[model samples]
Target chain A: MTDTITISVDAMGGDNAPRAVIHGASLALRERKNTRFIFHGRQEQIAPLLDEFPELRPASTVRHCETVIAMDEKPSQALRKGKGTSSMWMAIQAVKDGEADVAISGGNTGALMAMATFCLRPMKGISRPGIAAIWPTLRSDIIVLDMGATIGADAKQLVDYAILGSALARCLFDDDAPTVGLLNVGTEEVKGLDYIKEAGRVLTEASGSGFTYHGFVEGDDIGKGTVDVVVTEGFVGNIALKTAEGTARQVGSYLRSALKSNLMSRIGALFATSALNALRRKMDPRTVNGGVFMGLNGIVIKSHGGTDEIGYKSALSLSYEMARSRLIDKIGDTMQRFPIKVASEAPEAEPEANSA
Target chain B: MTDTITISVDAMGGDNAPRAVIHGASLALRERKNTRFIFHGRQEQIAPLLDEFPELRPASTVRHCETVIAMDEKPSQALRKGKGTSSMWMAIQAVKDGEADVAISGGNTGALMAMATFCLRPMKGISRPGIAAIWPTLRSDIIVLDMGATIGADAKQLVDYAILGSALARCLFDDDAPTVGLLNVGTEEVKGLDYIKEAGRVLTEASGSGFTYHGFVEGDDIGKGTVDVVVTEGFVGNIALKTAEGTARQVGSYLRSALKSNLMSRIGALFATSALNALRRKMDPRTVNGGVFMGLNGIVIKSHGGTDEIGYKSALSLSYEMARSRLIDKIGDTMQRFPIKVASEAPEAEPEANSA
Candidate 1:
C-alpha cells in the first residue's frame, strides 16, 4: 500500500471555519485518495460536520483544542497566549513532530507566521521564512515569494528568496531548474534598491548551480510570465499581489456591467456561456488559494481567511502536491548548493546614495 | 480676449514624437479654443509634421533645439550632456521662464524628473517632488502619488504628498476638501513603517484644515476608490501601478483567448462588439496617460512613452485643464495653509525597531 500523506488542518481558523475546513478536507480526499487528516479544533463541532460527510470519517480524526486565536489578534499576543493549546499552534505542531507531512491554516497571517516560525524554526542557513504565492500568468502559473512575510530584506535574504522561490517553482512545475527573476520598477541595470541589485549579482553567479537567473524583471513581467519564479522583498511583493487581485476583481466588475448594459449584450453573454465560464475559471482566485511558507524546516500553507470550502480545497490540494514533491528537501538541497552568508559577513558594497 | 494657455511641448521626446506632438496639439486646440503651443525640437522635423496639420501651424510655433534627450538616456547622462539645450529641458525652461503655462513630455521618467526638478526647483516648504498618477477605479478615478519619483519617503515627505495629491484632486474633481489616505500593507494602526504611522498622526491632526484624512488604506482600497487621494512611497506606489497594469493586460489576454477558443464564442464576441468597446474604452491606458509632477514650482505632465496620438492628445488635454484651473496657485495656497514642519522639528516619537 502507498504511504498516505498526513495533513494537519486548523479547523478553528478563518472566517467560515470548522465546516469549511472539514468540507474542504472531504473534497481534497476525493481528488487525493491516499491522504489522511487530523483536524485540530473543538472536537464536538468538527464531529457534527464530519458526520455530514460520512465517507470522510474513516480518513479524518478530530483532536480537541480549547483555544481559538482571534482573526485580528497581534502576532506577539498569539505567540504568547496560544503557544501549544490553540488550534493553529497544534496544527503546526503536528508537522514539527513529524506526525503530519504538512499543515494548512486560514488564520490571521501575522499570527500564523509567528507561531509557525516558533514551532518549526528556520531551516539551517535561513534567517527568516517567506510566503510564496503561485500566480496565474498568461503563459502558465509562476511562483512569486516573500509576499508580506517580513518587510525589507538585505541582499543575502533576497538571494535566499531566489533559492526559495526557485525551489517552489521546481515542485509546482515539475522542473528541476526554474528560471528566476528579481522584480523591480524597471528592467534596467541601474533601477531599484541596492539589495535587489546585489541579489541579482549573486543569483547570476548561482545560475548553473540549480536555478537559471533571468536577471531583473519589472512588475509587468510577472503577469507576462517572463520567468518561472519572481523574487521580491515582502513589502513590494505584498503590494503587487494585492494590487493584482484588486485589479482582477475590478476588471471582472467591468465585464459584468458591460455584459448587462443592453439586450444585445445580454443575448451575447448567453451564447458565450462556455467562453465566459472558461474566463471565470482562469480568473478564479480560489484555484490558487495557498501561499506556501518557505525557508522553514517544515511545510505550512496559508489559505485566504475569508475563503469558503472550494478555496480551502484548493489550498489542501497545494499542500498535498508540496508534500508529494518533498518541497522541503528540494529547498534544503538548493540551499546547500548555494549557502547564504550572514549579513554580518557581507562586504560593504553599498550602492550610490542617490540610487533610490 | 481670453488669455490663451501657452503649452510647451517636448516635440522630440517619445517614440512617435514631432508628429504625435503636433497632431495632439491640434486635437487639444479643437477642444480648448484658447490654447497655443511652442513646440521645442529640431525645426526641420517639426516643420514637416506641422505642414501635415495646417490648423496646428497657425496656433503653434516651433523652437529650434540642438539636442534631443534619448528615450533610454540615464538621468545623470542626460543632465550632463543635454542640459539646457535638449528639447525636454527647453520645454521645462519655458514653464520656468513663464513663457508657457505648463509643459508636457512623452519622454524618459528619470530624465524628465531630473530636468524638471533642476529647472523648476521644488515648491516652497517641499523637500521633494512626487509624481501623481490618476488611476481609474470602480467609483471613478483616484489620484495615487510618489509613483517612482523617489524611493522611500519620511513622515514629512509623506504628509507633503498628501497635501500635493489633495490639491490635485481639488483641481480635477472640483472638490475643495478631497478625502486622502496613506497606503500601507494593512489598515491596522500597527502595520507598515513608522513614517506612515507618524504621517497618519499628522494627517489626523490636519484633517479639515485642507483635506479630509481617511487614515490608512490597504492595496485593495485603491481599486475600490476608498478615498480621493492615496499617498504612498514611490517604491511601493510604482510597483502597485505597474502590477495593476500587468494584471489588466493579463486578464485581457485571457479574455481574448477564451473568446476565440470556439466558433460559438467568436460569434458571441462579434455580437457583443459595442459592449466590449465600452469596456475597452474604460480600460484604455491612453485615457489616463498623464502623470502629473506635483510639489514643483511649475506644472509638467508626463505621457506614456509608447502611447499613440490619442494618448498624447489626452496628455495635452490634461495640460489645458490644469493650466485653466490655475493648479500651481491652488497647490501654493494649500501649502501655505498647512506648512509642514521640517524633520528636525519633529518629536522623538519613533516606532518600535521590530515594526518593519
Candidate 2:
C-alpha cells in the first residue's frame, strides 16, 4: 500500500486552511485508492478539519507535522527562523524521511521556494528551480516558466530554461521533443537586447539537441501556443501569468455583459449552456490550480492561496500526477544531459552595463 | 482647406508601401474634409501613386521631398544618410518647414524617433520623451507610457512615466486629476525592487506635485482599467501589450472551437449573432490600430506595418482625432506645468551614447 503514490499536504497552510487541505488529502486517498495521505501541521490544528471528513479518522496513515510558516513572512528568513513551523519542517522531513512521495503547499511562495531550494536542493546540474505552469491558450497548451522563481537571468540561463522546459514537456506530454522559443520584443534577429540575441545564437547553434529551437516568439505567442515551451526572464514570466489571468477574467466579464445586453442573447445563452460550461471548464483556474517547481530534487507545487475545496482537490490530483510521473528524476536526467555551467563559467556572474 | 490639419505621409514606408500608403491617404482625404495630406518622397516615385489616386492628384496637396530610409538601418545612420531618402528628409523637412502638423510613419521606429528628436527636439522641460499608447484593457482606458520608446528604465524614469501618464489622462479624458499607478509585481507597499519601491513612493507622495498617485497596480489591473494611467519600464510595457493581444487571440479562438463543437452551438451562435459581433468588434486589433508616439515635440502615429485598408482607416481616424484634440500641445503644456524639468538642464553637448 505504501508503494503506491503518496502526497503530503501542508494542512495548516493557505487561506482555506486546515479543512481544505485535509479534505483534499482524503479526496486524493479515496479517489486514487493506492495513495497514502499525511497532514503537515499541528495535530490539534488539523484535527477539527479532518474530523469534518470523518472517514479518514481511523486511517493510521495520517501523519502530523506541528507547525506552519506564515504566508506573509520572508521565505528564506522564515525557513531558518520558522524551523519549528510544521509546514516547513514537515515538508523537508517528509522528503528526507521518505514518508511521502511529494509535498504540496498553497502557503507563502517565498518560504516554499526558499525551503525547497535550500532543503531539497536543485537537481544535479540544475542552476535554479523553475516554477512551470501550463497556460491554456487558443492554439495549444504553452508551458511558461521561471514565473517568480529565478529572479534575474542572463542569456545562458534562459537557454537552460528552454532545455529544461523541453525535457519537462517530453515527460509531461510524451511529445516528440518539444519546440522551444524565447519570448522577445519582435521576431527579427536584430530585435531585442544583447541577452536575447546571445540566447538566440546559443539556442540556434544547439538546434541539433533534443529540443527544437523556434527562434523568437513574442508575447502574443503565449496564447498562440506555436511552441511547446515559451522561455522568458522571471519578471516577464510573472507579468505574462498575471496578464493572461487578467485577460481571462476580463473576457469572461465582457462575454457576460454581451449576453445580458439583450433578451434574445439571454435565451441563446440558455441554449448554449453546455458550450459555455465547457469553455468555463477549460479556462477555470481551479481545474489547474497547482504550479510545479521543476529543476528541483523533489517535487513541490504552489497552489493558489485563495483556492477553495474544489480547487484544492485539483491541486491534490496534480500532485498525484507529478509523483506518478517521477517528474524530479526525469528533470535530473535532463539537466545532467545539459547543464547551465558550461558557458557561464568564464564571465563568472558579471553584471551587465546599462546602455540606456 | 489644406493648412488646418496637415499630416505628412511616408509614402515609401512599410513593407507593402507606395500603394498602401497612397491608397490610405486618398481614403483619408476623401473621408476627412478638413484635413490635407502631403506625400513626401521622390517626385518620380510619388507622382505615380498620386496619379493612381486622381482625386488627390489635382489638389496640389502632395509635396515632394525626395529621400527614403531603409527599415533595418540604425537611426543615426538613417539621419546621416537621409539626404536623398524620401521618407526621412520629407518627414523631417515637413515638421521643420511647418509643412505638416505631424509626420506619421509605418517606417522604422528608431529612425522616426531619432530624426524627430534631433530636428524638432524634445518639448521644453521634458528630459526624456516616452511613447504613450492608449491601451484598451479589461477595465478603463490606460495611458501606458514607454511602450517601447525608452526601454531599460530605472525607478526615476518610471516615476516620470507615471507622471506623464497621469497628466495625459487628465487632459485627454478630463479624468478628475486621474489616478497615477506604478506597475509592479505586487500591490503591497514594499513588493518590488528598490526601483519599483522608489517609484511607488514618488507616486504615493506625488513627488511634491499634487498628482493623484494611485497605489501600485498589478498586471491584472491594466485590463480592469483600475487606474487611469499605469506606468512601467518599456520592456514591461511591451510585455503587457503583447501578452494582452496573445491572450485575447487564444481565448477568442478557444470560444470559437467550443461554439463549433456541436450542431446546437452553431445554431446558438446564429441566434447570438449580435452578441458575438459585439465581442468580435471588441477583440479586433484593427479598431485600435494607430499607436501614438507621445512625448515627442510633434505628434507621430505608427500605423501597423501589416495593416490593410481598414487598419489605415483606423490610423487616419485616430490621427484626425488626435490632431483635433491637440495632443502635442497638451503634452507640451503638461511638461511646462510640471515642477520637474522635461529635459535635462544645461545640455552638456556630451557625445551621444550610440555614436557607433
Candidate 3:
C-alpha cells in the first residue's frame, strides 16, 4: 500500500470557501488509494461540513483554526498577518512540521506568493519566484512563468526565470532538456526593450548547455504548444494570463449566445454535440488549472480565480503529483547545477560577443 | 451625390505586400461607387498589375513613388530615411497636400505611428495621439484606445485617450455618449498605480460630461461590452491587442487540428459544420479588421499584421465609413468646443460643471 499522503488544504480560501474546498478534499482522499487531508478554518464553521461526509468519519479528519485572508486582500498584508490566519498558519505549519507532504490553497495569489516567500523562503541561488502555468496551445502544452509574482523585472531576472521554468519542466513534464521560449512582441533577436533584448542573448548563448532555449514566441502561441516553457516578466505574464481568460470567456459567452439565438441555433447544436463536447474538453481551464510557483521551497499550485469543484480538485490532485515527483529538490538541484549569470551582479564578467 | 473619397494605400506594406494590397484596393473600389484609391509604388512595377485589371484608364489614378521600407527596418531610421519611400511619401503628401482624404498602410506599426503623429498632428487641443480599435466583445463592439501610441502616459493622458476613444465611437459607431472604462487590475477605489487611480477619479468625477466615463474595469470585461470605450497605457494596450489576436488564432488553429485528429474527428466535423461555422463567424478577426488611429487630424486606420485580401477590404470599408461620417472634423470641433482640463496642463483653470 502507498504511504499516507497527508495534505493541508486552505478551506477558507476561494469563492466557494469551506464547502467547495472540503468537498474537493474529501473527494480527493476518496479517489486516491491512501491519502489524508487537514482542512483548516474555524471549528464551528468547518465541523458541520466535515461531518456531512460520513466517509471522512467522526471529525478527526479536519483540524480547525481561525482567520481567513479574503480574495481581495493585498498580498503583502496577508503575508504579514499570516500568523493569525488559520489557513495560512495551518498550511505553513503542516509543511514545517512534516505532518503534511504538501499544502494547497486557492487563496489570494498575492498573499500566497508573499506567504511562500516569507515562510518557505527561496531555494539556494534563486532570487525571484515565478508562477508556472500550463497553456494548452495547438502543438503541445507550454509552461509560462511569473504570471503575477513580481510587477517589474530586469533582463537578468527574466533569464533566470527561463532557467527556473526549464528546470521545473524537467521535473513536471519529464522533459529533461525542455525547449524554452521567450515571450516577446516580435521574434527578432533585437526586438523588445533593452531588458528583453539582453535577456534573449543570455538565453540564446546559454542554450543547449542546460535548457533547450528557443528564440521567441508571440501571445497566440501560448495555447499552440510550440514550446514547453515560455518566460517573461510578471507584468506581461499577468496581463497575458488575464487577457487569455477574459477573451476565452468572451468568445465562449458569445458562441453560446449565437448558438442559443433561436430555434434554428438549437437545432444546429443538436447535430454537433460530439464536436462541441470535444471543443469543451479541450478549452476547459480545469484540464490545465494547476499553476506551480517555481523557485519556492515547496509545491504550491494556484487554482484558477473562478475555480469550481472540478477545478479545485484538479489543483489538489496536481499538488499531490508534484509532491510525488519530488518537484522542489529536482528544480533546486537543476538550478544549483547551472546558476544564471546576471548582468547587474556579474559586473566585470567576460562579455562573450554581446548579440546586441 | 456623396463626395468622391480618395485614398492613398501603401502597396509595399504588410506580409502579402503589393498583391494583397492591390486586390484589397480593387475590391473596395469595385464594391463602392464614390471611393477612389491611389496606389503609391513604382509605376513600372504596378503597371503589370494595373494591366491585369485594365480598369485604371485615368492617368491621375496611381501615384508613381518608388522605394520600400522593410518590416525589420529600425523605426527611427525608417521614419527619417523613408521620406521617398512609396508608403511614407504617399501617406505624408496625400494628407499634407490634401491630395487624398486619408492615408492607410499596414506597414511597420512604429513607423506608421511616427508618421501619423509627425505628419498629421493631433487636432488643436489634443496633446498626444491614441489608436482606437474595435473589440468584438459579448455585448457589442467597443472602442479600445491607446492601443499602439503613447507608451507611458500620466493620469490626464489616459483620460485624454478615453475622450479620444469615446469620440471615435461617436463618429464611427454613431454612439453619442460612449461609456468609457479605464483598463485596470481591479475595480477598487485605490486599485492600480497612481496613474490609473488618478485617471479613475477624473473619469468618475467627470461623469455625464460629453462621454459617460465608467469606473475601472478588468481586462476580461473587454469581451463583455461592459463599456463602449476602454482606455489604458500603450504598453498594456499593445499587449492586450496582441494577446487577443494571438488567442483567437490559437483557438482557430486548435479547432482545425482537433478536427483532423482522426477519421472520427473528420466525420464529427462533417456533422458539426453548422455549429463550428457559427463559432468561426463569431471568432473571425476578418469581420473586424480595421483599427482607427484616434486623436489624429484625419481618419487613419491600420489593418491586420498577417491580414489577407478579406481583412484589407474590411479596412477599406471602414475608411469609407469614416469618410462618410466626417469623423475627423466632427471630433476636432468637439475637442475644441469642450477642452478637457487636464490637472497638470490646466491645474489653475477649473471650468464649472455647466461648461462641459
DockQ metric for all predictions: 0.55, 0.52, 0.29
Off by over 4 Å in 1: A187-192, A339-356, B187-192, B339-356
Clashing pairs for model 1 are: none
Report the poorest 10 consecutive residues by lDDT, candidate 1 chain B: B347-356
Clashes of each: 0, 19, 10
The C-alpha stretches of model 2 lying farther than 4 A from their native spots are A1-3, A51-60, A187-192, A343-356, B1-3, B15-32, B41-60, B65-84, B124-128, B187-192, B207-210, B340-356
What does candidate 3's lDDT look like per residue over A34-128, in tens digits? 66777778778788876786676532366667778878876655655665455865686677567777788888776776676666666655666
Better of 1 and 3 by lDDT: 1
Best by DockQ: 1
Per-residue CA lDDT of model 2 for B166-235, tens digit only, reads 6667656776477777777672322235677766665565543535777778888888888788887777
Residues B137-228, candidate 3, lDDT per residue (tens digit)? Answer: 87888888877565556787787787777777887668777889888766242212678888777778776666887888877778678899
Interface RMSD of each: 1.9, 2.4, 3.9
DockQ, structure candidate 3: 0.29
lDDT of 3: 0.71
lDDT per residue (tens digit) for residues A137-210 in model 2:
66556688878775567776787688778777776677756888898777242323678778878888777466
Q: Which rank order by TM-score, best down to worst?
A: 1, 2, 3
